[model samples]
Target: MEQGIIVTIDCETRTTREINLALREASLAQTPVRLSNPDCRHNLAVGVTTPLSVEIDGHVGYYCGGLCDGVDIRVAGDAGWGLAENLMGGRIAITGAAGSAAGATMRGGTVIVGGDAGARCGIAMKGGTLIVGGSVGVLSAFMMQKGVLIICGDAGEALGDSLYEGKIYVRGMIASLGSDAVISDLTDEDAAMLEAALGDAGIDARPEEFQKIVSGKKLYNFSTKEKEIWKTAL
Candidate 1:
């Protein structure tokens, strides 16, 4: 499979280290890479800071695009746990589902999942936008500090538990809200942002149909009277 100036790597024949080295070299050259037979390998393309575009033909295991900056990674299949973990910048798109903690502790960039995501989808996410075209499991945004999470399908129990400064938008049923998570009225500005975000993800949805979830601000300060809330969150 050859394209004009596109480098292709056969993951079936090369070791992970060799593949990554080749990726780094290609990135340095500012070339696009296409990987075939990824075979659910772990730790592929980790810590790459270059602004390269990568196309993976098959499923990828843990940390497929972790700790990257300014790269655009597209996985044609599913992704395992810790997908794009600690990502500083860039975009990671999974055509299929993603495992737990898909964007854990990521400070910036965008992550788009075309299918459902497992538990803790955006756990401890500090910044960035996570768009899930399908449902997300329990504790989806557990302890999220910043960023935006948009779920186009149903959300499981304890959605956005103990979050701070982050925003959540849900277009489907929410089983339950997590401690310190409360519903907030959507504003015109929010609608515009949602529209743009959904457009970027190529998801067709009306922003007005979604509901916003934000921190109740009760957990920001410890109060003796709010012990019950703290007990549940802590």
Candidate 2:
């Protein structure tokens, strides 16, 4: 186990194959691992079975940690598409920007992005907490189910198309709402829930300032006649 101000060193020389090798040899259980290189393109530390604190100093490619649990992960830079594709559970902190579909179809965990997120940020997210600081592009949460989509900045058009059984919150202006989602009037229960989730995600915005996006029930599955009717209409 390397110990000191610099405990671990993985220069992102190769794909994640080399990076994970460093992670495996680092003895992270014995020390705090820090990947200092910023230019590393490797998909480092994709699936960490061991519990450790890993901090990457720069942007990373897709599926940084597709599925991980019982670890504290922090990214000091931006992330590519599908940052945490199918996170089971853990705490992920992003200090920089994030790309499209940051947490696509994730089941559990918490994702915090301090900067803007690209389009389709959390499409089909089943469970988990996604917090985006800046704005997002069109179709941010299309078909989102069971989870929370927190947008501290504005949201683009057609948010949560055909969504079902999920909640979305935005602080800035909204461009449009999809067929399966809308800004429902908040009840006391909803306000409380939003406030609690935002608090857990380290977001300090008030519930009143936050706009909640609720999904529509139409897109859950296919209907018999209306399915064809809608298809013809389109």
Which candidate has the top score in TM-score?
Answer: 1
Q: Could you give candidate 2's per-residue lDDT for residues 38-119 as a string of tens digits?
A: 4736466667656656788887767776676644678888888777777777778888888888888878888888899999
Q: Can you give the TM-score per candidate against the true fold?
A: 0.93, 0.84
lDDT of 2 at 67: 70
All models: lDDT?
Answer: 0.93, 0.78
* Model 2: lowest-lDDT 10 consecutive positions: 1-10
Clashing residue pairs in candidate 1 (N, C-alpha, C atoms within 3 angstroms): none
Model 1 / residue 226 / CA error / Å:
8.0
In model 1, the worst 10-residue window by lDDT is 1-10
Best-fitting candidate, scored by lDDT: 1
